[model samples]
Target: MPTSRFEVLGAGAFPMLVHGALILLLTGSIIGSLRKIPADAYGRFAADVVAWGKAKRLVFVVFAGLGLYVAVMPVIGYTSSTFLFLITLLVTLAPKTRTALVVALVLALVFSFGLNWLFAEVFNVFLPRGN
Candidate 1:
């Protein structure tokens, strides 16, 4: 049976709709830009892409870690998952020094727990808690 319009727009529909629209806009922009690029520029674009891939490996790692964080949040609880994600990301990105490590740790703790506390205490919104 086909669902009604009301059912389609209920609950998580708004975010999904926004995401879809943003994706469409991004695709259109990319296609438009690529169409305007001259054939002679293809080699340069390819070289640029390769250089970016080599230099920005950490960017891919951070995105993968974020995906993992979202997947594990429901199982490990929001605070623990967020703390792990932030701390790991900070340590990965920060300089390899004792002071930097300490600063990253403090920032991770503050962001994870502070946000959690703010949401739960101030906003009266609760995140998922694992058993």
Candidate 2:
């Protein structure tokens, strides 16, 4: 007998269903895999994980780009920051060609500034206009 109103979870709430489902799933998995053979040896599972492999430079650049985007967003506004980020990603990932460049530029502009305009006009929402 609980006195609090929130103590009674009404209807099919998330915690009521999700938590039980997760518990059942984990318990079933644990029971089923009790005698199963392991794929990788326990100690060497992380041995090859440290190596960055061939795509190290690309991975690092993308990570840095994301960090820079977040850092510059407040200072340069969301539109400009997103434009730079999108342009960089599009240029780096797409094939090297004039058509690719034009498409990247157009997409970057459309997604960044165009979306900004849409939000401002249609949704009546204002974004940070830089510092």
Candidate 3:
């Protein structure tokens, strides 16, 4: 028995309709852009990508930090994991002045501990608490 106005494989009609519309819209957008962007723009973009690939310092540093954060999140819990992540980012990216460091530290603490408390008590959405 058919459940929706448009159904062939038992999917809901509304979802199917939305998906079909999105496909058409995205296809039209891609086709339009394909004709609009110049060939030299693509060549310049590719050269920039290649240059970034060759200079892998910033990209690799971020990837390594993410890997470490994921690996230790279970051991340290959500609060510590988030705080450490923010601190690491600040240390690497933020200015080295004393005032900037102090402000970043304060913000990191508030984000980590404040968010944990808000989730657990206010929203009753408990986050992971590692041992």
Candidate 4:
């Protein structure tokens, strides 16, 4: 069953729904533009998508990691969940280099700490600490 935006977002869903509708409108316009493109262009575009997909197995890994991270995050604590999420996403999305891994680690640490601090200090929201 599809969740209602109201159920998920509380009162904020009204604005979010407006944004979502605008995005759909924009997407429709893009599709219309694409349809006006020459048939040869469309064929080339399709080929490009196929070639890109074949070259980047990383796409699969990143999407799978995102799905898993969403499912697992609420069950675990934020720190552990975000760490796993960042590492997996980075490994899948970027080149596997020592510098890349280090950058990802730093980014994950900053994101986790800043987000946690913002919620706790500014918003007075307390996230679960599974430990």
Task: By lDDT, rank the candidates, best first.
Answer: 1, 3, 2, 4
lDDT (Cα, tens digit) per residue for candidate 4, span 19-53: 99999999999999988888787659878988898
Task: Indicate the residue-level lDDT of 55 in model 1.
Answer: 99
Error of 4 at 71 (Å): 0.8
Candidate 4 has an lDDT of 0.80
TM-score of each: 0.62, 0.58, 0.60, 0.52
Among these predictions, the greatest TM-score belongs to 1
Q: Write the per-residue lDDT of candidate 3 for residues 1-131, one digit (tens) a residue.
A: 36765655565667888999999999999999999989888769978888888798767778888899888888999899989998988778778999999988998999899999999999999888888
Q: What tens-digit string does per-residue lDDT give for candidate 1 at 1-131?
A: 44467665565667778999999999999999989999988779879999999899998999999999999999999889999999999999999999999999999888888889999999999987865
By lDDT, who's the top model here? 1
Tally clashes: model 1: 0
- Model 3 regions more than 4 Å off: 1-11, 50-72, 113-126
Indicate the worst ten consecutive residues by lDDT in candidate 3: 1-10
Candidate lDDT values, in order: 0.90, 0.86, 0.87, 0.80
Q: Total backbone clashes of model 3?
A: 0
